[model samples]
Target chain A: MGQRTMSDQELVQLYLTGQEKALAVLIARHQDKLFSAIYVLVRNRAVAEDILQDAYFKIVSTLKGGRYNEEGKFIQWAMRIARNLVIDHFRRGNKFPTVTDSEGNDIFTYINIPEENQEDRLVANERDSKLRQLIEQLPAEQREVLVLRHYADLSFKEIADLTQVSINTALGRMRYALNNLRKLIEKHNIAL
Target chain B: MTKKITQERIIQFVYGELPFEETAALFDELDNDTEGLDYLESVAGIGTLLGSLMVSPSKAIRDNVLAFSAHFTEE
Candidate 1:
């Protein structure tokens, strides 16, 4: 079977045995979800890219050092690393990530699906940036729950375990997040 | 008697985290409740919007990572 079709565990084994592409396959499989998950929390493209790169190096280091315990999903482990890095960024900045970067650019665009025209692309970018700002405005806890559940691809139970809360608490936070986002959209009249 | 479908349950249903049986149960319970259905739509609607907002790392960044992986053992 092709490495692309293999399970993550199988890929890890192949990567261990000197197949570099196996590692590439694994990164391709999870990068979008992982990067997007981090981006949502950190709220900046440049910083998210940095965290993702650092997370990749950390992931490679751990795998090479024979320290990764493959008891759970690989993405979950990577998610934890990226998450801690984002938290570190928050501590360093002494606040939640601002929506814009140093030069005031919000360059969050999909990796695939190229836009047809500059006007349409600009419009979409503006709308998406507005939505992300609204997301930034969510209460931190609720936003965390939303990112963990939606972007991290974690179940509410997994989120509860990660966040040290009950499943009900996680679920409640997600519900609040959705409702709050709805209100934000209405209040701001965001097109999306 | 129908169990009242809570927003939390709707949230799970919307996210596809709810089990099939439970989803069918909620699907049935929500069939007659316009407000519940609308709430489900709102949750799902926002989720779709959020999904669209996701961005990918630039190609150069990914290439750099792949290169890092390629020579990781040699370094």
Candidate 2:
């Protein structure tokens, strides 16, 4: 099989063996999810993009510096780095950006959905946009849990550790996220 | 003895975070209660909808990261 078909672990091994393209392949495989996780927190495309690049740079340096020892969790490690950068950015600024600026533009504009039919695609896109809006409407903590769980693909335990909350709190936030989303779907009659 | 099934437990069950025994217990409870089953379906459906949305950084970001990766080599 080609490098395209290699598993993440295989790609990491290949990169370690001096095949630079393997690193490219691995980044391609995870950029979207990593970017999404960052955007969910920063809510600004430009800032998220910068943070993603910085995170990738750090990831490469870590790999080269022999500091990255996680065998099959390169993506998770990269995500943790990106998340920390985002937190630092906010902490330094001492203010988190609003979910949307006065112009109401947000990262959801970057979502690209694929579907077979034009009508179905439009409907699906609308549903997705509505869902995204609802998620943005969720309380910050709830949205953070949901984003970390789904976008970052972190476990509830990891989320608890990262957010410095108990596992029950993390799970509770996820439960409330779902419940609130359900309420919003019903309230708005969103067909999903 | 049976444990009470809260929404938190249902969320854990939906996300595959529950232990196998708790999962089995939840499944048993759901098998007996239509409302519980429906609630689980609703939660899971929202999850499915959330999963359908795909967000990515712009092409510029992807290209920049990939280009940087391509040029880096461990010395």
TM-score of each candidate structure, all chains considered together: 0.89, 0.79
TM-scores for chain B, in order? Answer: 0.79, 0.71
**Runs in model 2 with CA error above 4 Å?**
A1-10, A69-72, A89-111, A117-119, B1-5, B73-75
- State candidate 2's TM-score: 0.79
Q: Taking the tens digit of each residue's C-alpha lDDT, what string does model 2 give over A1-192?
A: 655567887887787777888887787789888887887677666787889999988887777677778854666677778888987888788444534434454434535667778777767756665676788799989998998888888889888877889998898888788888899999989854
Clashes of each: 0, 0
The candidate 2 chain A region of ten consecutive residues with least summed lDDT is A101-110
Look at candidate 2 and tell me the lDDT of residue A176.
84
Docking level of model 1: medium
**Tens-place lDDT digits, model 1, residues B10-39:** 888878888898988887888888888878
Report how closely model 1 matches the true complex, as a DockQ value. Answer: 0.62
